[model samples]
Structures are given as C-alpha cells and as structure tokens.
Target: MSRGSTLAEKIIGRAAGHAVQPGDLAVVAVGMAMSVDSIAPSVIKVMREEFRIPKVADPEKVALFVDHVAPACNVSTAEGQAEVRRFAAEQGIRHLYDVGTGVCHQLMIDRGLARAGEVVLGSDSHSTAYGAIGAFGTGMGATDIALAFATGKTWLRVPETMKVELTGQLPAGVMSKDAILHLIGRLGIDGATYRAVEFYGAEDLTAASRITLCSMTTELGAKAGMIAFPQERLAEFGLPEWLFADPDAGYVHAETIDLAALSPQVSSPDDVDNVSSVDAVVGIHIDQVFLGTCTNGRLEDIHAAARILKGRRVAPHVRMIIIPASDDILKQSVADGSLISLLEAGATVSTPGCGPCIGRHQGVLAAGEACFSTANRNFRGRMGSPEADIYLGSPLTAAATALEGKIADPRNYL
Candidate 1:
C-alpha cells in the first residue's frame, strides 16, 4: 500500500513526475517566475553575462514588474526600469506590469497568473503570496531566478509540512490580519523555519483573507505556505483531490488558531514577530497611517477601512495614505465609492503599486516619527530612518489609528 503524502509532497511529486517526500530535492518546471525592477537588472545580467544563455525556455512564462521604487524614484531607478523594458520587449515577454500596476504577487493573482497545484517563483520573499491560490510559490535568489529564466526550471528541497489548523469563525471587528499576527506571535520568528505550512481548516476564511494568511508565512520563516481546499473551494480554485493533504499525511508540527477568540493584533516595530493585541499598544501616537501592500491591499481590505472612515475625518495631526494593490482594485474602489470615502476622510491616494510598503518613496517615515501600516515586515529601518517606528495591523486597525491619531483598537470604531 502507498503511504499518505502531504499537500506539498503531492504538488511537488506531480511537478516532478514522480513521488516525493520531505527532504527530497526536486527540479520542476516553473509555471511562472517573476522579477521586480530592483533585482531584474542583476537577474538579467546573470543570465546574459554569466551563463550567456540564448533564448529563455519560455518567455511567456516569465514576468517582470517595475513596482518597487516605481515612477522613477531616482535617475538610477529610471535607468534600471528602462533596461527591464528593453529586455522584455526584446525577449517577447508580455507579462511586464510597469509603474502604477501594483505589486508582483497581487498582479499575479489579479491576472490569474497563479494557479492551484502549480509552482510559481518570484525574486521577492513575499513571493510566497502565490500560495494563496494553492500554488507552490517560493522565493529564490537572483542567481537561481536567472537560471530559472534561462531554463524554465528550478530545484527545491521538499520541506517538511507543518499543519496549522484554523477553526471557528472570526468575531466581528477582527480581520484575517489579526489571525496571522496571532499565529506569527505564537510561532515566533523562526518557528516554521524551512517548512511548508498548510492551513487545514481554512474554509471560514474569505478568499482575500486566505491570501493575507498565506503571504505572511514568510514571516514564520516558512519555505512554502498552502491551504487545503474544501470540496466547494476545490472547484473554485481548480484544485485536484490530491492537492488536499491526505488524512494520514505526516506533519513535522501542528497548531490550531481559533479565530473567534482572536482580537485585533499588531506587530510592533523592528520585528515582524513582535506582536501583541491591539489593546496592549493602544494610544501610541502615530504620524501616518498607510493602507496597502500585497498583504492587505485588496478590495475587501479597502472596504474595511472605508467602513471605519466613512463620515469620519482623519485626525488633524495624522496623515492617511491608501494605495490599492492593483489597477483593477483601484477601479473597483473608485466605482464602489470606497475610494471617495477614504479621500473625503482626509486620506491621500497614490498610484496603485507598492507605494511605501518598501519605504523607498510615497510614505517614508522621518526620524522620531511613527506609522501604522498594513504592509508586512516592520524590520528596523524597513520604511525609512531606523529611528522611525512602524506598527503593523489590519486596515480596520489602521483606519482606527488615523481616526484617533494613535494606535487605537479597530473594535472600538467598529
């Protein structure tokens, strides 16, 4: 009799055209490999200068995004973007999303570039976001990405599985961001190091929420994050039966999160894992409140903020910025009037892209300043001056902060 295999095992096995288990090395065809502007120059260089490869295995499978430091933050960035444009045109790559198009991972899902049970690669660590749709997505270095671009293939050591079971409905005023923050806090920074985390009981989570949950797996130091699709969702995601983890599949570790009991959580500055409940850090003065990023930049997140900010003006001392994750989301928000609500509430809007998530432009923090941001990662100096502080939370939490000019609980406003 055959042994039961995990979600990661089965996906990797199918891609490898053979059975695979934890610790196995498998070189599989990449469905898509994404490179952002900041690293595309080096990726292209390695492919051309080092390997001297001619003609990528499939130009159609390669994607490039000029999102980070977009709109020419500086002359050097402008030149780098130009190089990417020339290369894409020359190589017949049609998946280039230039400035204002939003994040690479968001664009990937927005355009249906990521599919269930497939492998997706990105140059950014948050590439794990692709796992939102049940795809085997992971980040690779410039050299590995260049090699994948040249041959349309890359290898990964199959990671052991960590089953994270999420049960119970999330109570009112709580968001998926809180659940993920709670998980990260309990698991610690390196809790799931080099492991694949599969959410076993995620049926209650909205599709957008699932994206938020999966993308933050990187903070747990996970290699890949996957969600086991329920029968109804299986059809929606086009996932196969095998894509679901077997009942008897082995797991390196397991934990459960009860959403109903979870409250709004926050990741304090200088560490993504430095998390606590909203009440614990309430009333901390905030200079800026930013709402956008692959983590919380979708329409649902925007609606959450609008619900809180509608008819309420931002505090006079606070600056609020909302950037949609994609052009489509931007249009939807505008059509639905949520964008107007945010703007009327004294929030400024930037072009739909990464914005200040990376801290290069848009909403950089000043020394001694503090911001409440929806983006992932709040490492020291992550957004600007190391002296500046960043507080990570849900859009609802961010809206509450903007409304009060401090780190207030979203539950209070909701």
Candidate 2:
C-alpha cells in the first residue's frame, strides 16, 4: 500500500523523480533558482572563483533580480549591479529583471517563472511568497544558489509537515497580515522550526492573500510554506499538479484557525510576536505610514488602501509613503487611478521598488518616532534608526493610520 504523503513530500518527491517520505535527504532538480542584487554578487563570485564553473546548467531556469537597492544608492551597490548584469549577459542568462522592474518574489510569479507544484528557491528569506500560488518555496544562501546555478539541482532534507487549516471567511477589515501575525504570536518565533507549513483552505484565500500568508510563515521559522492551489487557477498558467496531501496524511502538528473570530491585529515595536488587537493599541501616535513592500504591495493591497484614502488626505502630522511592489503593479495603479488618488491624498508615492521596507533610500524614521508599516519584520533598525519604532499592520491599517496620524483600526475606516 502507498503511504499517505504530505504536500511537501509530494512536491519534493516529484522534483526528485521518485517517491519520498518525510526526513528523506533528496537531491532534486529545481524548477527555478532566484537571486537578487544584494545576493547575486556572492553567487557570481562563488560560481567563478570557488567552483570554476564554465557555464550555468540552465541559464533560463535561474532568475536574477535587481531590486533591493535598485538604482544603486552607493558606488558599491552600483558596481554590484553592474557585475550582476555583466555576469548575466556573459552567461547567456535571459530572465534578469533590472531596477524599476519589481521585487524578486512578485516578479517571479508575475513573469510566469513560478507556478503550482514547482520547487523554487531564492536567496531571500521572503522567497516563501511564491507559496501563495501553491509552489514549494523556500530560502537558500548564496553558496547554495551558486551550486544550484552551476548544477541545476540542490539537496534538501525533507522536513516534517505542519497543517494549518483555515476555516471561515476573514472578518470585515481583517487582512491576511493580521492572521499571520496572530499565528506568529501564538507559535512564538521558533514555533515551526525545520518544518514545512502546509496551508489548507484555498477557497478562502485570494492569490494576493495567500502570498501574504506564505511570506510571513518564514517569520514562524518554517523551512518552507506551501498551499495546494486550485487546479482551475493553475490551469490559467498551464501548470499541472501531480499530488496533494491525502485526507489521512499525517502531520506532526495541526491547528485550525477560525478567521471570523479574528480582529484586525498589530505587532508592536521591536518584535513580530508582540501582537495585540487593534483596539488595544488604537490612538497610539505614529510619525510615518509605509504602504508597500513585497509582503503587501500587490494591486489588490493598493486598491484596498486607495479605497480608504479616497476623498481624504493623510494627516498633516504624519508622513505617508507609498511604494508599488513592481513596475507592472505601478502601471496598473496608475491606469486605474489608484496612484493618483494616493498622491492626491497627500501620500508620497515612489518608484516601483523596495523603498523604506529595508530603509535604504526613502522614508527613514527619526529617533523617537514610530512608523506603521505593512512590511514584514519589525526588528530593531529594520527600517533604519534603531531608536525608531516600527508597528506592523495591514495596508488598510497603514492607510487609516496615515489619515489619523496614529495606530487606528481599519474597521472604522472600512
């Protein structure tokens, strides 16, 4: 009799061309290996100096993105991007998305490079974002990516599976960001260490919402985040799914969350696990509101925020910064008047790139000031100024706070 297999086992097993069980060390060929400007230089160096590799196994399968410091803030960064561009051109790589293109995770899916049932890995921790579309997505280091670039395969220890079942529709004004933060709060930071988090209940998740959920599973210390995307959705991309976890598949841990019982939530300064209901922290003053990042910068998020901001202006006391996740999203926002509404609402809209999420070029907070942002990770100095505090919230919360100049509940605005 065939043993019941989890989603992680099925995907890894497929890529390895054999059936695999949990805890098996399998060397599988990757469907796609991704790298960004900050990490690509190291991959290039290792491929050239460490491995002496003559050619990439399949250049088309390896995608390089120039997002994290796009447009090059400093001479060092400019040189790094130049090196990446030169290397890509020399190696006949064709899928390099340059600056102003989009964040790596968003571009991976928007460009049709990532799809359901494929095993994809990137050099950024948020690579798990692709799991929204039902891909097995995880993060790898530069050396690992370089090896994959050279050989087109990487070894992974099959991880135990944890089932996170979603039940009931999300309550009004509650976004996936709140649900993920709530989960992280319950699980603490290391809750899912070395485990694959299989998210069930696709019927309740939009493509964007699923992306938000999977992106933050990394914060729970998950090895990889996965969802069994619906076949009709994958059919749009012509992707096929071979296996899904059986109804009886064994999971090391299982938890079901009722979204209807959840409320809009927030993660306080310096810790993602420091979570509370919006009512608990309402009216706390904020100095800035950042409305975009790889986590929640999609068109859906933008539209949600724009709906809240329409016919209103941001508070004069607060600085509101908006950045679209990608050039395509940016163009869509502009075409649909979302960008115009945001700008007219007194928000400062920047080019399509990671702006203040990593605190590089724009909207750095000042000492003793606080920012409400939709981006993941509220660690000290994550958005510059270790003395500055960051509160993590959804786009709706971000927009409401921008209007009120404080931590405000999005439900009131909705």
Candidate 3:
C-alpha cells in the first residue's frame, strides 16, 4: 500500500519524478526561480564565475526584480540594478520586473508564473507567498539559486510537516493578518523551524487573504507555507488531484484555531513574536502608519483600509503611507477611486513596490519614532532606525491607528 504523504511531499515527489517522504533529500526540477535586485548580482556572479554558464538553464523559468531600493536610491543601488538588467538582456530573460513594477512575489502570481503543484524557488524569504496559490515555494541563498539557474534543478531535504487548521469564520473587523500574527505569537519566533506548514479549513479565504496567511508564515520560521487552495478557483491551472495532504498523513505539530473567536492582533516592536491584544497596547503614540507590503498590500487589504478612512482624515501627527502590491492593483485602486479616497484622507501613496518595508527607502522611520505597519516582520531596525519601533497589524488596525495616531484597535472603528 502507498503511504500517505503531505502536500509538500507529494509536490516534491512530482518534481523529483518519484515518491518522497519526510527527511528524504532529493534533487528536483524547478518550475521557476526568482531573484530580487538586491541579490540578483550575487546570483549572476556565481553563475558566471563559478559555473561559467553562458545563460540560465531556462530563461522562461527565471525571473528578476528591482523592488528593494527601487528607483535607484543612490549610485550604488542604481549600478546594481543596471547589472541585473544587463544580465537579463544578455540571457534573454523576459521576466525581469523593473523598478515600480511591484514586489517580486506579487508580480510572479499576477503573471501566472506560479501555479498549483509547482516548485517555485525565490531569493527572497517571502517566496512562501507562492504557497497561497498552492505552489511549493521556498527561499534559497545566492549559491543555491545560481546553481538552480544554471541547471534548473536543486537538492533539498524534505522537511517535516506541521498542520495549522482553522475552523469557523473570521469575526467582524478581524483580518487574516490578525490571525497570522496571533498564530505566530503562540508558536514563538522559531516555532516551526525548517518545517512545512500545511493549512487546512479556511476554505473561504480569498486569494489575497491566503497570500497574507502564507507570506506571514515565514515569521514562524517556516520553510514553506501551503494552503489546500480551492480547486475550483484554480481550475485553469489544472492543479493535480493530490494537491492537498493525504487524509492519513502525519504532522510534527498540529494546531487548531477557531477563527470566529479571534480578534484584532498585533506584534510589538523589535520582534514579530512580541504579540498582544490591541487593547493592551493602546494609547502609545504612533508617528507613522504604513499600509503596504507583499504580505498585506493586495486589493482586499487596500479596500479594507479605504472603508475605514473614507470619511475621515489621518490624525495631525501621524504620517500615513500606502503602496499597492503591483501596478495592476494600483490601477485597480485608481479605477475604483480607493486611491483618491486614501489620498483625501491625508494618506500619502508611493510607487508600487516594497516601499520602506526593508529599511532602505520610501518612508523609513526616524530615531525615537514608532510606526504602525501592515508589513510582516517587525524586528529591530527592520524599517529604519534601530532606535525606532514598529507595530505590525492589519489594514483595519493600520487605518484606525492613522486616524487616532496611536495603536488603536480596528473593532472600535468598525
């Protein structure tokens, strides 16, 4: 009899052309490999110098991005992006998403580069974002990515699986961002170290919501995050019959969370795991409110914040910034007037990319300041100054914080 295998195992098995189990090391063919501008130079150098490869194994399967420090913050960054562009041109890599196109992960999904039951590797940690669409997405270092680019195959140790099951519907005013933060808090920073987290239930999660859930799973130290994506929704992708975990598969750790019982959750400064209820952290002044990132910068999140900021303007001392996930989402927001509404509410909008989330450019915080950001990851010095602090929350909470200039809860405004 065939042994039951988890989603990660099955997808990997397909890629490796054989059945696999946890702890098995296998070299699998990659469906796609993405590299961001910040690290593309390293990958390019490694491929040329180490492997002496004339070009990547498959140009169609490779992607590059100029998201971090986009728009050329300085001479150094501008030169670095130029190098990436040169390589893409020389290698005929047609998928190089240049500055302001959006975050690499968002563009990958929007462009249909990642699909269900495929193996997508990225140079960015948030490559787990691909899991929202049921892809086996994981991040790798420069050398590994270069090797994959040169050979279209890479070896990986199959990780044990962890099950995160959600039952019941999300309560009023509660966002998927809140649920992830709460889960991360419970599991601690390193809770699921090197583990593949497979989500069950939450069948109604929108594509955007699923992306948020999987993207933030990286905060739990997860190697990959997979949701049993609704098959009907991804019909065009022709997802395999066994995209989900087998019924009899085992889990290293299983956690059950009732979505209906959840409320707005937040992660405090210096650490994503430093979490507490919004009620516990209210009244603390927030100098800035940033509502965008690969985690929560999708259309749904923008709509939620627009609804909150519709008839109100941001508080006097609070600086609100909103950057959509991609140009497509940005255009959609404009067509729907959400962008104007947010701008009218005294919120500043920036180029469609990873704006200020990586402490590089586009809204970096000042010393002694605090920011309420919808982006994942809030470790010390993540956004800007090490002395500054960041509070991670949902779009609703972020809008409320912008209105009240403090760590305010979304429930009150809702």
Report, for every candidate in turn, its global Cα lDDT versus the true structure: 0.90, 0.87, 0.90
> In candidate 1, what are the lDDT values of residues 1-414, reduced to their tens digit?
467888788888888889998898998888899899999999999999998996677998999998887787889999999999999999999999999898888999879887778888999988888777889889888999999999998899999999998989988889989988999999998989999999978766788898998899999999888887865557666676556778888998999998889999999988888999999999999999999999999999999999999999999999899999998999999999999999999999998888888789999989999999999999989889989999999999999999999999888877
lDDT of 3 at 354: 92
Clashing pairs in 2: none
What would the per-residue lDDT of candidate 3 be over residues 194-247, giving only the tens digit for each residue? 999988875587879989999988888998999875446445545676686778
Q: Give the per-residue lDDT of model 2 (tens digit) for 126-183.
A: 8888877768888999999999999999999999999988888898898888888898
Q: How many backbone clashes does candidate 3 have?
A: 0
- Backbone clashes under 3 angstroms, per model: 0, 0, 0
| Cα TM-score of candidate 3 | 0.97
Give me the runs in candidate 1 sitting further than 4 Å from their true place: 231-233
TM-score for all models, in order of appearance: 0.98, 0.96, 0.97
* Top candidate when judged by TM-score against the true structure: 1
